[model samples]
Target: MRALVLDRPGTCDTLRPAELPTPLPGPGRVRVRVEACGLNPSDYQRAAYGIPEWEWPAILGLDVVGLVDTLGEGVTAVGLGQRVAFHGDIRERGGFADYALADATVLAPVPDGLEPARAAALPSAGLTAHQAVVRRLRVGKDDTVLVTGGAGGVGGFAVQLAARAGARVIATEAAHNTDHVKRLGADAVIDFRGEDIAARVRELTDGRGVDAVVDTIGSDSATANLGLLVHGGGLAAVAGRPDLNAVAPFGLAPSVHEIALGAAYLLGDHRSRVQLSIMLAELLEMAADGRLDPMLSRTVPFEDVPGALVELSGRQVRGKIVYVAS
Candidate 1:
């Protein structure tokens, strides 16, 4: 297997080509021949954060759509050659290669209408959005919800899902993406670059703040965005850095939640794994029916993985970027 391995945490140069042995499934796992993989923010963050425990030459991709090559002992759900999509196992080699390992508990069959690149795009972003808006916040009819970074991958999905749940969806994005965000089902789009987001939200809601907020953009602005939520409202943020000091002064006393799909998938417990699998299946079904769109931005050949990482680091992509296996 030829893989783009990260020798250490640093620039794109850290990713170099090397021939490694193909991984075989261990007990309760599956070996998937990679067909397509999605590049995610977490992939770059894992390298940039340079966590002390991370091993050198690590494979960093997360979302994979591939064909099952073999199954490990105790696995009975899928057979060889079935097209599947799942969260790629975090290890020495990942979906950036020709093959990757996956836990059988997380694998979901690719439905008829979903393309491999689109399927690859769904795992991380789709699961994050679903868990944050639908599960954690319990957004529903008549609820006013604000989603930041609304044109980005997870934020776009959050907008769609919240609108689908009948929430009055308000999203913040660059002025150029106003129409793009609106097409994704946002009831109103705020130009984060030129407008006061909190003021706009207050105006939209008749001087009351939103019922909940999903923050995909983590920064000082994200902390202030929390002030846009009504008292006792909720927040589900993907970014961990928020100014905790601002929480109470807002007088909202909001419930804060973080979306950690990878942590739950890697929990190695049967119940957690089963719950993730079910959620993945439901998301895939929605994608197949065209009710949910992964919003694939571009698909490049596997050789472009390293360069794609560089481009993704700039944060210019509006939606998912996929690597199609040769």
Candidate 2:
């Protein structure tokens, strides 16, 4: 199979063409024909963070929607020709290929009425959002949640989920995305570039602060986000660790999370499968009903993966960049 393998992890061009034998399913694995794949921040982070070194010839993908072309022995759940999506195995090449094998344990039947590109965009970002709000924090009715980077991939989903869970949402975004983010169900939005996010949350909550703070962007915003949460409230940072003491002065002990997508999907149990199913159902239902929109910025052919990723590293994107396998 032709895959955009990380021949050498130096630059995007290093992710050149490579001929690798098509992968076959092991006892419980299923071989999938790649259709569409979504790029995540981790994709670039992996390359820059010195993870997928060239000597390894790694494939850079973790989430995809594809057709099950073959199934390994004893894999009784999914069948051949079934269109499904999941967080592809991290131990192997990512979704940047024509054919890749997936573990049936993490695979979910694509919800009816969902498009492959759309579905592909959900697994990584959507799963992160679901983990932070639905599983970790468990945002419930009447909760007030503040999601930083509200228009971002994970933040967009977080805003929607938190709102859908009956939480009053105050999201932080750039000036231009304020309205765009709010339509996703945020009750209020602050321009991180223009407004004081911490103060905005306080104002929205009438000095009480939000119940949970989900920061999809960190390295700069994590510490401040902690201060926006109420005492004893939770703070989930998808990017990095936050200063717990930022909320300590307020009596709030923030719970920080550094999302490990691999662990979330491969937690040797039914936990990953159950969560994957539920999030897919909710996101697909919202999309099918026009209540959810991905704000997809663009689509690139499989061959353009390298070039596309270069631009993605700029951190100027408005939404998901989908790579459609053709």
Computed on alpha carbons, the lDDT of every model, listed in order, comes to 0.85, 0.79
Task: Highest TM-score: give the candidate number.
Answer: 1
CA deviation > 4 Å runs, candidate 2: 50-55, 265-274, 289-291
TM-score of each: 0.94, 0.91
Cα displacement (Å) at residue 170, model 2 = 1.0
Tens-digit per-residue lDDT, 1-326, candidate 1: 88888877777647887888887789999999989999988788777755554556677788989999999999999999999998755543568888888889888899987899989889888988999999999999989999999999899999999999999999999999999999999999999889988889989999999998889887675688777878888888887656767866647788888787766644656777777778888999999998988899899986788888888888878999999987
Query: What are the clashing pairs of model 2?
Result: 8-54, 231-252
How many steric overlaps are in each model, in order?
Answer: 0, 2
Count: clashes, candidate 1: 0
Tens digits of per-residue lDDT, candidate 2, 95-141, equal 88898777787787776778888878888888888889987899999
How displaced is residue 33 in candidate 2, in Å? 0.4
